[model samples]
Target: MEHIRNFCIIAHIDHGKSTLADRLLDMTNAISEREKMDQVLDNMDLERERGITIKSHAVQMYYKFEGKEYTLNLIDTPGHVDFSYEVSRAIAACEGALLIVDASQGIQAQTISNLYLALEHDLEIIPVLNKIDLPSANPEEVSDQIIDLIGCKREDIIPASGKTGQGVDKILEAIVKRIPAPKGDPNAPLQALIFDSVYNPYRGIEAYFKVVNGTIRKGQRVKFMATDKVYNADEIGILQLKQYPKDEISAGDVGYIVSGIKDAREVKVGDTITSADNPADAPIEGFEEVKPMVFAGVYPVEIDQYEELRSSLEKLRLNDASLTFEPESSAALGFGFRCGFLGMLHMEIVQERLDREFNMDVITTVPNVSYIAYMKKDPTVPVKVNNPADFPDPVKLDRIEEPYIKAQIISKSEYVGSIMKLCIDKRGILKNQVYLTSDRVELTFEMPLAEIVFDFYDRLKSISRGYASFDYYPIGYRESDLVKVDILINGDPVDALSALVHRSNAYDIGRKMCEKLKELIPRQQFVIAIQAAIGSKIIARETISALRKDVTAKCYGGDITRKRKLLEKQKEGKKRMKQIGSVEIPQKAFLAVLKLND
Candidate 1:
C-alpha cells in the first residue's frame, strides 16, 4: 500500500491539465512512444475539438524511483466549472491533487474553486505552475499568487512547462515524495468505492473503482450497497491504456470490475461494492448527490423515438452520472424527458453527444434554473418547479423563490467596469471585489441562477477579451418578483418555450424573443403571429407575412373589380388557412430564445 500513489490533476479550463498528464504518462513510460498524442486522456472527439476535457479519465502507471517500483494511479479531470462533479469524484478516490495554474493567466476562478474542493476532501495539494514556456508566462508572479492562495512555500511550487516536458521528472519525484500513499487494511471486508463507470456494448458495464478495504477478486460475487444487487465479477482488471485482467486487486489499488451487468441503471456512481458473502459494515461516505443547476426538456425530433431516447439517456447516464432526467410531456413538443444539467455548457455537450454518439436528433427547449413555488393555500409546503410548464397558477401562488449563486470572476482590471455592468444587467448584486494584483481583480457577485443561464458567459468572455475566468456555486433560494413568460404562436401558448423570469426584465426579454422568433420561424401559407405574453397581457408581438403566390398576376389585365375579387378570394383563403394552420416551430426557434442577447 505504501508503494501506491493515487492522485488527480485539477485546474481551470485550458490550464494544461491534459498536457501535463501526457508528460507524466510519458515520463512514467505508461504509454509507448507510438501511443503518444496530445490530450491522450481526452478520448472523446468532442473534447478534443473543443480543446477541453469533459469526462474524467483514469490510468495506472508504473514508475521506478531510486530502484523501487512504485504504482501510480492517475486520474485526469475536466477543468470546466460545468463538470466540477467529475473533479469531485476524482478527488474522492485519490489522496492528493496537482493544482495546475497557467503562469500567464495566474489564478482564475475555477482554479480557486477546484483547489477548495481538493482541500475540502483533505487531499494533499501540489501547486504546479504550468505553461512556463509561453513568452508571456510570469512564473514569479503566479508563484506568489499560488503561495497566497494555498499558503505553500515558494520553493514548494514547481515551475513546469507541460509542452516541452520541462520539470516533469521533478513532478514525478514530488508525487512520490509529497503525496501520501493509499491507506487501507487488506484483511478487512471488501469496500470499494465506484468513482466512475462506462458502458461496453459487447461486454457490459465496466465500473472503475478504488478499493479502500479488502480485496476484489475475479469471479467474486459482489454486491453494490446502494442498489443491493449482486453480480459475479466476470473479469477484474487494472486500467492502463487498455484493461489488463487480474486475478485480484487488493486494497489501496484502483481497478475495474466487469460483471456482465447489461442494465445501465443497475450500476450507480459513488456506490460501494462489497463482497456479497462478507460485506462491509457500512458503505463509503462523502460522495454527495450531484445537484444540477440548469434544467431543460430534451425531446426527440421524431415523436416515435421516445423509447429510444430514453434508452440512449440511460446509457449516456452511465458515462455521465451528473445528468439527471425524468419522463415529461409538453403540449408543444410531445413526450420528452426534463433533464437537469450542471450548466449551459454541460447541457450543450449532452445535446451534441446524443446526436453524434447515439445518432439521436433531439430538440432541447429553453434552459432555466429550478424554482421554489409556494401556494397561497399551502404556504408551508414548498413546491419544487423545474419546468415552467409545472409552475403553479400565479393566482394561487403566494410567492416564487429563485436559486441564487455566488459568482466569482477573475479578470483584468481594464474589463472590470464592463463585467460589472453585464452582471448588474442580469439582476446581480455586487457582493465583494478585491485586487489580487495591480492589474488583476477578483469580483464576487450574488446573481440569480436563471440570469446567467443564457448568454452571460459568452458576453463576459467578449467583454474581457477572453481574459476572464468565471465560476459559481448555488447559494440556495431567495424570494424574488418573478413572472412566468410564455411564448404564444398564433395565440396558442407553447409550453416548451415558457420560462420563469424576473419581472424587471420580462418585457425586454419578451420583446427580444418575439423579434428573434420572427426571423427564425419560416413563413407559412398564412400570416404567423408570434406573441410573448404574461397571462392574458401581450407584452410583445411580431408578425411574419404569408408566402403569397401572386394570385392577382393571372388577372392583371382584368377589370379593377375582377382584381379585387381575386385578392378578396386569396385573403379569404388565407383567413381560413390561418384558422386551421398550426405553426411548425423549427428547432432553431426554440434555441434562439437562449441567445436573445446575441
Candidate 2:
C-alpha cells in the first residue's frame, strides 16, 4: 500500500483527459508502442465521433521514482457536465487528481466544476497545463489562472502536450512524489467500493472496484452491500490497462471481481462489495446514483419494433442507472416509453445508441422537466408530472413548481453582452460575474432547467459563435408562472405535443413550435390547422393548405352544367372530409419541433 498511488485525470470536455491518460500509460510502458491509439480510454465509437468522454475507465501503471517502483492506478473520467457523476465517483476512488487545463482554451465551465468536486473529495490536485504544442497555447497564462482559481502556485504546475508526448514522464514522476499512497488496512474486514461495472457475454458481470480494506480473492464469497446478493469471486484480475489475471486484490489496490452474475441489474455502479462471511460493519461512501432531470417520450418509428425497443431499453437500463422509462401511450404516436435522462446530451446519446448499437429506429417527443403540481383542494398533496397526458386540469392546480439550475458559462469577453442577453431571454437571473482575464469572463446565473432544455444550447452557440461553453447543476424546484402549453391539431389535443412553458415566453415559443411543425408536417388531403393553446385559449396558430386533387381534369369535355354539379359535389365531400379526417403526423415533425436549431 505504501508503493501504490491512486489518482485520476480531471478536466473539461475536449481538454485532453483521455489523451493524457494514454500518454501516461505509454510512458509507464503499460502498453506496447503498437497497442496505442488516440483516446484509448474512450473506446466507444460514439465517444470518438463526438470527441468527448462518455465513461470512466481505470488502469494500472508501474513507474520508478528515485530508485523505488510505484504501482500507479489511474482513473480517466468524463469531462462533460452530463457525466459529472462519473467524475465524482472517479475522484472518490482517488487520493489525488491531475487537473488538466487546456493551455489554448484556458479555464472552462466544466473545468471549474471538476475542480470543485476534486476539492470536495479532498483530493490533492496536481495542476497540469495541457496542449502546449498548439500555437495558441499559453502555459504561463493558464498557470496563473490555475493559481488564482485553485490557489496552487504557478511553479507547481506542469506543462505538457498529450499530442506530442512532452513532459509526460515528468508527470508520472510527479504523481509518485506528490500524490499520497492509498491508506488502508490489509487485515480489516473486507470492504470494496464498486466504482464502475460492465456486462460481458462470457464473463457475466465485471465489477470494477478499489479495495478499501481487507482482501478480495478468487473463490472467496462476497456480496454487494447495496444489493446484498452473494457471489463467489470466480476470478480476480488487475486492470493493467487490460485485464490481467490476479490471485487476489489487497486493500488500497484496484481490480475487478468476476462471478457468474451475467445480469447487469444485479451489479450496480456505487455498490459496496464485501466478504459475505466477514462483512464490514458499514459500507464506504463511494458513489452517488445520478438522477435524471430531463424526460421525453420515445416511440418506435415502426410500430412492430415496440417490443424490440422495450427489450433494448431494458438492456441499456441495466448498465445505465440514470436512464429511466415507463410505458407511455400517445393518440398520435401509438405506444412508447417515457424516458428520463440526465440532460439533453444524455437523451441524444441514448437515442443514438438505440439506433447505432441496438438496430432500432425510435422517435422521441419534446424533452421536458418534471413539474411539481399541487392540488387546489389540498395543497399538501403534491404530484410529480413527467408527461403532459397526466397533467391535472387547471381547475385542480394551485401553483406549479419547475426545476431550476445554477448555470455557469465561460466565454470570450467580447461575447459577454450577448451571453447575458441570451441568459436573460431564457428567464435566467444573473447571480454573479467574474472577469477571469482581460479576454475571458465567467458568468453565473440561476435559470429554469426547462428554459435551457430545448434550444438554449444551440442558440448560445450561435449567438456566441461557438466561443462560449456552458455547465449547470440542479438547484431544486422553484415556484413560477408556468403553464401547460398544448398543441391542438385540427381541433384535437395531442398529448405528446404538450409542454409546460413559462408564461413570459409562452406566446413566442408556441408560435415558433407551430411554425416549425407546419414546415415538417405533410399536407393532407384536407386542410390542417395547428394551434398552440393554454387551456381553451389559443395563443398561436398556423395552417397548412390541403393537397388539392385535380377534379376538373376529367371534366374537360363539359363545364356548363354537368361539370358545375360535379365540382359542387366534390367540394361538399372535401368539406366533410376536413371535418372528420385526421392528419397523419410523420416522425420528423415531432423531432423537428423539439429541435430549435436555426
Candidate 3:
C-alpha cells in the first residue's frame, strides 16, 4: 500500500490558496483533461462568484514521483477572518499545513493569525511563496519576512506561481517528505471526524469526514457520537471535485459517506462518526460550538410568498450549517423568522441567494449583535437578546458587555495620521505600531466589534487610495453603556429596524439613520412619516413625499389587458414594502438605515 499524507492549504484572503489547489490537481492529473473546471473544490455558486472559500472542501489524489506513488489528501480552508472557526476545524484534520504567502505583499494580518493556529495544533508547517509570475514578485524579501515572523528556515520557503504552475512539483514533493504518514490501526472500529456536510434532493444528506483510526465500507452500520443516531452506510466515496463511488476508505483518507439521512440537522459538522458495533472510546474533543454573531429577521414582500421564503431558507441551510432560523411574529409586519449568521458577509450572501436563486422577493431586518442582560437581580441567569425590542429596561441591565476585536491595518506611511484620527473618532484604542518597510507601516488597535462591523474598512481604503488592508479578530468583551433606539412608523414599533447604540451618540446616529431611510424608501401614494424615538422622546424624524401622480392615469375600456397589467405592477411594487397602518416602508429602507456609518 502507498503512503498517505494529509495537509491543508492556508492563506489570507485573495492570497491564491484556491488557485494553488487547482494547479496541484492539474499537475497530478487528479482531474481528467476533459473534466477540468475552475476552482474545482469551490462547488458553490456563491463561493465561485465571490472568489473566496466560505466552507472547507476536501479531495483525495494520487501523485507519482521517482516511480513512487503517494496518496495525497488535501483540504481547502476559508481565508476570511469571519470563518476562523471553520479554519481551525480544517487544521485539526490535517497532519501539516502549507502556508501560502503573496510574493508582492509580504505578510498580512490573517497570515499571522492562521500561522499561530497551526503552531498551536503542533502541525508541521511548509511555507510556500506564491505569485512569482507578477512583475512585482519579491520571493527573496517575502522569504526573509516569513523566516522572521514564523521562525521557519530560509531554505524551507518554496517559491512558485500558482497561476503559471511554477514550482508546484516542489510543493507536492514537500508534502510527501515533510508530512508524516497515517499510522493508525485499520482493524479497529471506524472512527471519523466530520468537518462538513450538505443536503441534496436526490442523494439526501451527505457527510464529509476524515477517517482517523479505522476502516469503513459501503454496507457497514455507523453511529454519530454526538447525536447517538445509527445509520447504514448506503454509499462510500472520495470527492474528486464531486462524489465518486468507492468500495471503501481507510484511515487517513478524506471522503464522503451517505446513509439515507433526510434531516439536515441530524448530521452536524465537527461531530464524530463511529461503527455501531464498537463505538469510539470518546468523541474527538476540541470541537467548539459555533454561535451566530449577527442576527436579523427575514420576511416575504408578498404575504402569499411566505411559504416560498421558508423554502428558500431551507435550501440555503442545506449547504450552510452556520445559518440558523427561528419562527418570529412581528406586530407590525406579521410572521417571519429570526435568522442568525457568522458575520455581515454571511448574512448578505444568504439574502442575495434567496433573491437570485429562488426567484423570491425578501424583506430583511437590520442585523444586530447578541447582548447579555440580567433581570430581577439574577446573577446566574443571563438572557441573550438579538433585537432591541427583546432587550430589558435600562434599569434592569446591571452591566452590559459588548464584544471587542483587535484590528490590524497596513497602509502607506503618509496616511498614518489620517487613519489614526479616524480610528480615534470611532473609539479605537491604539495598541502598537511598527514600520514594516520604508513606505509601509502596520498599526494595531483594540476597537469595539460594532465599529468595525460598519464600513470602516471601506473608509480606510478610500482615505489611503486603495493602498490599505485591514483585518480583525474577536478579542474579548468589555462593559459599555448601551441603549436600544426603536424606530416607530405611525406610532407603532417596526421591530425590524430597532438598534442598540452607545448612549453618547444616540441623537446623531438616529438623525443619520433616518436621513438614509428617507432616501431609500420610495414615495408612496400617501405621505409616510419615519421617526426614531427612545421612550416617548423623538430623536430624529423624516417624511417620504407622496407620489406626484398615479402611474396609470390614462386607462380606457378598450385597453383592459394593458390596464390590468399596469395595476398588477403597481400592486406588486406596493407589496414590496412593510405597511404600518397607512405608512409604506420599502425593504431597502430598512437595510440602508441599519448601518448609519456605512
Candidate 4:
C-alpha cells in the first residue's frame, strides 16, 4: 500500500524517545483514552526502573488525516552508547528515522553520534525537537544546531514536547510526506528482518520482525537465513502497544511471530526470517554480532544459592541477548558465573536487575578489560585473557594492545582547566575542542577505554558539579606497556583481586587498592597484613586493625549454646577465605578491595 510507512525513533539517553512513542500512539488512537499507559513500549521492569530502553520495541498504529488512512509501524530504539550496535541494526530495518533532540539540552555528543549513524544508513531523517514544555526550553537554538550539525533544512525541524503531546501531528505528517513508503512485492518470496526477540516460559520464543516482501501467515513455515533453522509459525500478531492477533502480515508491517523455539540461541536479534518453501536468495545485510567489552564474575552471597543464581541468569539472558554468562569456579567463591557486558552501564543494569527483580543477593568482582597474551617461544598460540590472573609472565609478553576510545565531554568553560587536568591524568590525548555556546564547550580526546570504564564519568560529574555530559565510542586498539598486578593475602595470590595496570600507574593503583582493602577488611582477632607486589618487590602494604577483645561477657551456662554458635559462625567465615599458609583472610575483603573508587 502507498500509505504504509516504517520508521524508528532515535535520540540520546534521556531524550524522551519512549515517551514520544507513547504520545504518538495516543495521537493515532491506537490505545483508548481510558487505557493510556506510560512508556507502553518499555515492557521490561529493568527498562522502566532505569528510565532507558535496553531493547528496541515495535508497534503498529493506524492514523487518518484529510480523509486518508495510513498504516504506521513505529519502532522504539535504545539511545545509550552501550547499545549503539543495536541501534544501528534497528535503523537498517526502517525506511525513515525520527531524530528526537532535547530542547533544553541542545545537541549532545550522543545525539550527534546517533544522528550520524542514521545518516550513514541513508534513512530519511525527520528531526523532531522534544521537551519544549520544559522551563529552559530553547527550540530556536536547537533547531539551528540541528541544521548546522545534520545539514537538514530549517523547516524540517519539528518542535514538540512528548510529555504534553504538543506538535506531534506535524511529526506524523512529515513521516508521510518526507519518508518514502515501503517498496517491495507482496507477491514475491517472503523476506523479513528480525530486529528483536524475547523468550517466554508459556509461549516459547517470540520474534519481532518487519516484512520487506511477500506475506507471512500463521500456518506458514519459515526459515532463518543466519542459522538455517526451520519452524512452523504457530501464531502471527501485530503490536498495538500490546500483542494483537492477526491472520497475516503484509509488506511494510512490523509484528511478532511465535513458534516452539525454547532456546534463545536459536533465535538471534539480527537474524532474517523467510518462507521455507520459497525463501529469499540472500539474507539482509548489516547485522553484526554484539561483542561485550567488560567482563566480571558474579558470586552469590550464600553458597547454596548457586542453582538459583544460574536459573536467574538464564531467564535474564533469554530476554536480553546482549547479556552473556559462563560457569566459573573459584577457590574462595566455589561456584559462580563469569558475566560479560557491552559496557559499564550494561553491567550495572544487569546487576541491579538481578538484585531488585530476581531478589538475589550477589557479590561481584571488579570489571576487567579483555587482553591478548603473546608468548615469546609460542608466538602463534595467542591466549585471550579476561582475568588478570590469567596473564602470562612479563618475559613472555612481546607486545600488548589495549582498547581505545574517542571520548567527548560537554561542560561549562569555567571547568575547562579541571576537565583538562583529569583527562591528562588518565593518559588521554587532546584531540580537539569547540565552543557550542557562550558558556558551553565540547572537548574531544583519545583515551584508553579501560580508564573510563569504571567511575570516570562520575568523577567528572563531581568535578563539574553535575554540569558536564560525557560520551565515548570505541576507536581501535593501541600498543601499551601494560602488566598484570597480582595481589596476595599473606602468601597466596588472590586471583579475584588481581588487576591489569599500565607500568606508569602501577604504584598509584597499588596504593589505592591497599587503602580500599583496609576499609573493607574488618578488625580481626589477630593482625592481618595485605600487600600488593610485583615480582618479589612490595609496591603497597597495609595492616587491618586487630579486634579489641572477644564477646566473653555474654557467655553463661545456658548461653553456652549461643557462644558456641557464634564461634562456629566466626570459624566458618574464616574458612571461606583463601588460606595462603598461615594468614586468615575474608572473601568479602578481597571483593571490596578489588573495587578501587579512586
Candidate 5:
C-alpha cells in the first residue's frame, strides 16, 4: 500500500480535465499515444459529442520514480454540476484530488464548488493550471487568484497545457510525492467502496470498487451493504481504458467486480462491498444516496412504444444511478415515466440516450422542483408533492414551500448589473458579492431552482456575452406565494400543461404560456380555447379559430335558401363535434413549449 496512490481530477466543465487525463495516461505508458482517442477517458459517445464527461472512469497506471515502481490509481471525474454526485463518490474513494483551473478562464463557479467538496473530504489538493499554450493564457493572474481563493501557496501551483502535453510528467511526479499511500490492513475483513457501476449484456452488473481493506478474488461471495445481497464475484479486473481480467484485487487497488446479479438496482453507487461470510462490522461512512434535483415526465411519441421505452430507460438507468423514474400518465402525452435527474443537463443526456441508443421517440414535459405543502386544516402537517397532478386544492393548502438553491455566478464586472436583474426577475435574493479580481466578480444569490432550471443559464450567457459561468446547490426549502397554474384546452384541464409559479409572476407567466401554447397547438375543426388558471380563476386566455372547410364553395350557383341550409347543417355538425371531439395535440407542441432549451 505504500507504493499505491489513488487520486481524482476535478475542474469546471470544458476546462481540460479529460485532456489532462489523456496526457497523464500517455506519460505513465499505461496507454500508448497511438491507441488513445480524444477524451480517451470518456467512453460514452454522448459525452464525446457534447464535449463533457457524463460519468466517472477509473484506470490503473504504472509509473517509475527514483528507480522505484509505484501503482498509480487515477480516477477521471466529470466537472459539470449535474455530475457532482459522481464527483463526490469518486472523491470518497480517493486519497487526493487535482484541482485544475483554466489559465485564461481562471477560477469558475464549479471550480470553487468542487474544491470545497475536496476540502470536506480532507483530500490533499494539487493545484494545476491548464491550457497555458493558449495565446490568451494568463497563468500568473490565475495562479494569484487561486492563492487568494483557496490559500494554496504560489510556488505549489503548477502550470501545464493539456493540449500540448507540457508539465504532465511533473503532475504525475507530484501525485507520487504529495499524495500519501493508502493505509489499510490486508489481513482485515475485505471492504470496498462501489463508486460506479455499469450493466453488461451477458455478465450482469459490473461494479467499480476501491478496495479499502483485505483482498477480493474471483469466485468469492461479496455483500453489498446497502442492498444486503450476496453474489459470487464471477470475475475481477482492472480498467486500463478497457477491462483486463484478473484473479484477485488486493487492498488499495481499484478494479471492477462482476457479480452474476442481473438487476441494476441491487448494485448501488456508494454502497460498500465486503466478504459475505467474513463481513465487516459496518459499511464505510461519509457516503450518501444521490437524490434527483429535477423532475420531468417522459412519454413515448408512439403510445405502443411505452414498454420499449420503459425497458430502454431501465437499461440506461443501470449505468446512471443518479437517474430516477416511475410510471406516470399524462392527459396530453399518454403513459410514460416521471423521471428525476440531478439537473437539466442530466435530463437532456438521458433523453438523448433514449433516442440515440434505443431509437425511441419521446416527449418530455417541463421540468419542476419538488414542493412541500402544509395542510390548511392541520398547519403542522406537511405533504411532499412531486407532481403537479398530486397538488391539492389551493384552499386546502395553507402554505407552499418550494425548493431553493444557493446560486453562484462568476463573470466580468460589467455584467454584474445585468446578472443581478436577471436573478431578480426570477425572484432571486441578493445574498453577497465578491470581486475575485479587478476584471472578474462572483455574485451569490438565494434563487428558486425552478426558475432557472431551463432558461437561466442561456439568459446568463447571453447577458454576460458568454463570459460568465454559473453553479448552484440546493439550499433546502423556503415558503413562497406559489400556485399551480393549470392549462385548460377547450375547458378541459391538461395535466401535462400545469406548472408551479410564484403568485406575483403568475399573470405574466400564465399569459406567455397560453400564447406559446396557442402558437404550438394546431387548429381543430372547432374553435379551441387556451386558458391558464390559478385554481378556479382563469388569469389568461387565448383563442384559436377553427380551420374552415369552406362549405359555401360548392354553392355558387345554388339559391339563397340552399346556401342557408348548408350553413345551418354545417354549424350543427360543428356543435356536436365541439362536444365530442378531443384535441389532437401534435407531438411538436409539447416538444416546442416544454423544452425552451435548444
Candidate 6:
C-alpha cells in the first residue's frame, strides 16, 4: 500500500490536463509506442469531436523510481464546469490532485472552483504550470498566481510543457514523493467505493471502484450497499489501456468488477461495494449529491418509440449518473421525459449521444431552470416548478422564487465593462470584483440561473474574444416577478414552447419568440397566427402567410371580373382552411427560439 500512489489531474477546460496525462503515461511506459495518442483516456467519439472530457477515465500505471517499482493509479478528469461531478468523484477516490494551470491563461474561474473542491476533500495539491512551450506562455506570472491561490512555495510549483514532455520526470518524482499512498487495513471487511459505471451489451453493467479496505476476489459474492443487491463478481480486473483480468484486487487499488447485472438501476455511482458475507459496518460518506442546473423535455420524433427512448436513457444514465429524468407528456410534443442536466453543454452532449449512440430520433424543447411558486390560498406551502406549463395561475399565486447563482468570471480588464453590461442586461447584480493582476480581473455577480441558460456563455466568449472563463454555483432561491409566457399557434397553446420569463423582459422575449417561430415553422396551405401571450393578453404576434396556389392562372385574357372572382374564391378557400388547419411546429424551431440573442 505504501507504493500505491492514487491521484487525479484537474484543471479548467482546455488547460492541458489530457496532454500532461499523455506525457506521464509515455514516460512511465504505461502504453506502448504504437498505442500512444492524444487524449488517450478520452475514448468517446463525442469527447474527441468536441475536444472536451465529458467523462472521467481511470487507468493504472507502473513506474520505477530509484530501483523500486511503484504502482501509480491516475484518474484523468474533465475540466468543464458541467462535468464537475466527474471531478468530485475522482477526488473522493484519490489521495492527491495535480492542479494544472495554463501558463498563458493564468488562473481562471474553473481553476479556482476546482481547487476549492480538492481542498475541501483534504487532498494534497501539486500545482503544475502547463503549456510552458507556448510563445505566449508567461510561466512567472502564472506561478505567482498559483502561489497566491494555493499558498505554495515558489519552488514547489513545477513548470512543465505537456506538449513537449518537458519536466515529465519531475512530475512523476513529485507524485511519488508528495502524494501519500492509500491507507487501509487489508484484513478488514471489504469496503470499496464505486466512483463510476458503464454498460456493456455483451456482458452487463461494469462498475469501476477503489478498494478502501480488505480484498475482493474474482468469482466472489459482492453487494452494493445502496441498492442492497448481491451479485457474483464474474470478472475482476485493473483498468489499463484495456481491462487486464486478475484473480483479485486488494486494498488501495483501483479496479473494475463485472457481475452480469443487466439492469441499469441495479448499479449506482457513489455506492459502497462490500463482501456479501462479510459486509462492512457502514457505507462510505462524503459523496456529494448531484444538483441539476438545467431542465428540458426530450420527446421522441416518433411517438411509438417512447419506450425505446426510455430504455436508451436508462442505459445512458448507467454510464452518466448525473443525468436525471422523469416521465412527462406535452400537449404539443406528446409523451416525453423531463430531463435534468448539469448545464447547457452537458445537455447538448446528452442530446448528441442520444442520436449517435442510441440512434433514437428525439426532439428537445427549450431549456429552463427550476422555480418555486407559493399559492395565495396556502402561503406557507411552496410548489416546485420546472416546466412552464406547471406554473400556477397568477390569480392563485402569491409570489414566485427563481434559482440564483453566484457567477465568477475571470477575464482581461479591457472587456470588464462589456461583460458587466451583458450580465446586467440579463438581470444580474454585481456582487464583487477584484484585480488578480494589473491587466486581469475577476468579476463576481449574483444572477438568476435562468438568465444564463441560453446564450450567456456564448455572448461572454464573443465579447471577451475567448479570453474569459466562467464558472458558477447555485446560491439558492430569491423572490422575483416572473410570468409564464404561453406561445399560441392559431389560437391553440403549445405547451412545449411555453416558458417562464421575468416580467421586465417578457415583452422583448415574447416578440423574439414570435418572430423566430414565424421563420422556423414551415408555410402551410392556410395562414397561421403565432402569438405570445401572458394569460388573457397577447404581448406579441406574427403571421405566417399561406402557400398560395394561384387559381387565377386559368383566367388569363378573360374578363377583369372573372380574374377578381378567381382571386376571391381562392381567398375564401384559404380562410376555410385556416379555421381547420393545425400548425406543425418543426423541431428546429424549438431550439432556435432559445437562441434569441444569436
lDDT of 2 by residue, 315-367 (tens): 67655657888998898888999998988888988999898878998888988
State in Å the error of residue 142, model 1: 0.8
Backbone clash numbers for all candidates listed: 0, 0, 0, 0, 0, 0
Model 4: per-residue Cα lDDT over 458-576, one tens digit each: 78989999777788877877878896777776656777778898989998888888788777766655557778888678899988754544655567667567887877776655555
TM-score of each: 0.99, 0.96, 0.90, 0.90, 0.97, 0.99
Q: In candidate 3, how many Å is residue 596 off?
A: 3.5
Off by over 4 Å in 5: 591-598
Q: CA lDDT of 320 in candidate 1? A: 99
Q: Which ten residues in a row have the lowest lDDT in candidate 4?
A: 576-585
Q: Of the candidates numbered 2 and 3, which has the greater lDDT value?
A: 2
In model 1, residue pairs whose N, Cα or C atoms come closer than 3 Å (at least 3 residues apart or on different chains), thus clashing, are none
lDDT of 4 at 49: 83
Candidate 3 lands at a TM-score of 0.90
lDDT of 1 at 66: 93
**CA displacement after TM-score superposition, residue 214 of candidate 1 (Å):** 0.3
Best of the two (2, 6) by lDDT: 6
Ten-residue stretch with the least lDDT total in model 1: 550-559
Pairs with backbone N, CA or C atoms under 3 Å apart (clashes), candidate 3: none
Q: Is candidate 1 or candidate 4 better by lDDT?
A: 1
Q: Candidate 1: TM-score?
A: 0.99
The CA lDDT at 47 in model 3 is: 90
Local distance difference test, candidate 5: 0.88
